[model samples]
Target: MDIGAIAAAVMLAVSVRKRLDVFDGPADITTSLMMVGPLLVLGWLVAIALFGGYREDVFGVGTDEYKRVFNASLVTAGMLGIGCYLAKFQLSRGFFLLAFVVGIPLLLMGRLLLRSAIHRARRQGRLQYRVLIAGSPAHVDEVAAVLRREPWLGYHVAGALVPAAHLAEETASGIPIVGTTEHSTALVSTEDADVIFFAGGALSSASQLRTIVWELEKAEVQVVVAPSVTDVSGERIKVRPVGGLPLMHIDPPRATDAARWGKRLFDIVAAAFLIVAFTPLMAYAALRVRLHDGGPVFFNQVRTGRDGEHFGCLKFRTMVVDAEARLAELHAQIGFEAGLFKMKEDPRITPPGRWLRRFSLDELPQLFNVLRGDMSLVGPRPPLPREVAGYESDMMRRLRVRPGMTGLWQVSGRSDLSWSEAVRLDLYYVDNWSMLQDLSILGRTFGAVFGSRGAY
Candidate 1:
């Protein structure tokens, strides 16, 4: 894949230079293709390998592979620039820029497609590594549950190895208890396990764990140790050795003021662009709302914003004027809790309202809220004042960041998510947000809106 990408980039550069007549040297395509192209490809491949792009640990999982690819591309570009300058080659700047611009996305897309294929195969029980879990009974159950929930991670729990005292139990999280932890090596050989996962302080000490790992290594079995912590990004965790003992250092989940300011600037720019681009569609939706009910075209409701402040969140009206008055009856009929109020087929929705809600056209007016500094292009969902009143202390952490027009909850499941699940996602977004993550969420929002998976 890397070689193909490099070749494609070279071809594009050559074609662009020829068409534009930008190069000032002898335009010998055959010589350049045979000489410069091979050198460039070799250098890029070497850079990629040096940056750990081919590491098996990151294969078929997570964003590590993409990050490595990006780092390798940057290194390769830097090397090429220095080489051209030192050698005094008259390479077209436009050609170099265009080649890299085209190449990076092509490489990322190819890897993404490959990952999707691997995930599909894993979901079908193919290409899975058999895992023998060694931990306390509770920890074993916890790890097994997580592995079971995320099958695409490619780990299939073959069984569990608990302490001998707990061998009376038949299973841990539906995985049979095969043997005691003292007999883990024999169990691994007997079960033909490819990996042994130690969850939550499984071994007595670091020395004991190291001994186990050394034994596993001799048998060609991989060992994974899971820390007790959860819901933290790897970027925030650093391993430092103190007195030859490894200690994990965790950073706080707060963004610097500069990052916050940058996010605000991005929100303003994106909201402005979207408002201008979607003006016609917003106008038509407003006209439809006005024509449907002969009532207010815009709906403004008090919602909780950053730091628990109140703001009027704007939206195109998608229900009857008496929708609030009928809320009590509707809630009783549908048996919905006060935390989240959503009905797939509500009687209060007008003909046009249903269509508007289905495609999220009703939320277009929230761009104005974004521009007004009450919301953002990407953040946690804005909650009603009544809903905010019901939040637990931990759940209120979501209010630290500005609300958004579309958020993690909206893209993930929207109205179909349970109240607890929605809160968890919102809190996750609040704690782990980054510029790249915001951009990624915005990109996914378009597909989510078009698919309308859980919009209504």
Candidate 2:
């Protein structure tokens, strides 16, 4: 709606300029007819709003939000452009170009400003949601801690209802314990909660949870459940309604060749283009690696790719030549796991590596891998073949797709994710593979890389 209105203004400027003829001759009464064009544009603007283009919440966070905005606006513009052509209205090409160029950024900026303002209001407590939590004390405490930390999420922990036999005194986060499990339905209405979170393992019985869900239906409060399983992504869970019951089906992970050919084609073209574009920069990076530390510019190591294949992964050397040798020493000092080692303040990182890692500059050389068909523009994380050797059957699903330079795990919290979370995301990507989805992930990669949320 905002975009259409803005575009209408642009069209009006065109009509006014073309019809006025003020630079050459005096304006005539027929010039007043130009107002009719703007009136029609206003009608189009209302139509666009009625088509669901004006709603903001669907575009709240992540790429889906921006996708909805862009897709809807483009559809509306395309239809309007067609209508003008069919009606034999000779609109200025400049008018259409100007409107498109100006309107998209304007609408995007408007949404950004609105989101910021709403977040600010939520932080100030002017906008808040009263919520009831249902679960064991531990789960209740975990949920409560997150809410307390980020008040802008808008949840106000009103109270809790524990299972009757647990005998837990109160939530560790200090929300009052209001009722026993038996009176869960009554307690929600009394507290007038906007949302109810069924927290943790204590809600072991689905029949009981369903009964509570049935009661909440009458109260008209939103219900969210925290599953007992940890580190599960929602994409992997499918709720199928069979007969009268909703059965949760967990889909096994697999990447098929149905879209694989198209994806491979896309990666080939995009990677080929990027490698050419960044050749000079790559050359400079190679120089820097040699100058900073007199060693090899490109570090090649064996990494696992699709279907357990080993490929030489290329990265700009971001550490000392002896970094591999020093790993055991550092692990001994830090006492990390034999298989998975992390040195928070590793001394092996070169000065350039630290800066390179910070902004993801070190990964640029992987364009060669992408072009060589050993990697993809987007897919699962490339694990060491050693890491793949230890994979559970479920973890092996990540190898179905070609390893990517940037992927779901890359953009989604990066190293901050637990190993289980990373595997879940990788599997989810393989199961739900789409070229459009890959494009969306690639767009988000910029923000993730630049934001540096979990780089090292």
Best by TM-score: 1
Candidate 1 per-residue C-alpha lDDT over 1-456 given as tens digits, one digit per residue, 9 for 90 to 100? 878887898898778766765646555455545666778788888988899999999877768899999889888888888988999976667667777888888788888889989988998999999999888888888888778757888899988888777785556357788888888788899999999998864677778887777777779999888777766666678999999888999888753431388999998998899999999999899899999869999999999998999999998898899999999998888787768888887889988898899899999999999888999888888999889898889988888888888888988778888887788788877777777778878888887888998977
**Model 2 CA RMSD to the hidden true structure, in angstroms:** 5.5
Against the unseen true structure, what C-alpha lDDT does each candidate score?
0.83, 0.74
Pairs that collide in candidate 2 are: 59-65
Please give the RMSD to the true structure for each candidate, in Å.
2.6, 5.5
TM-score of structure candidate 2: 0.75
For candidate 1, the 10 contiguous residues with the lowest summed lDDT are: 251-260
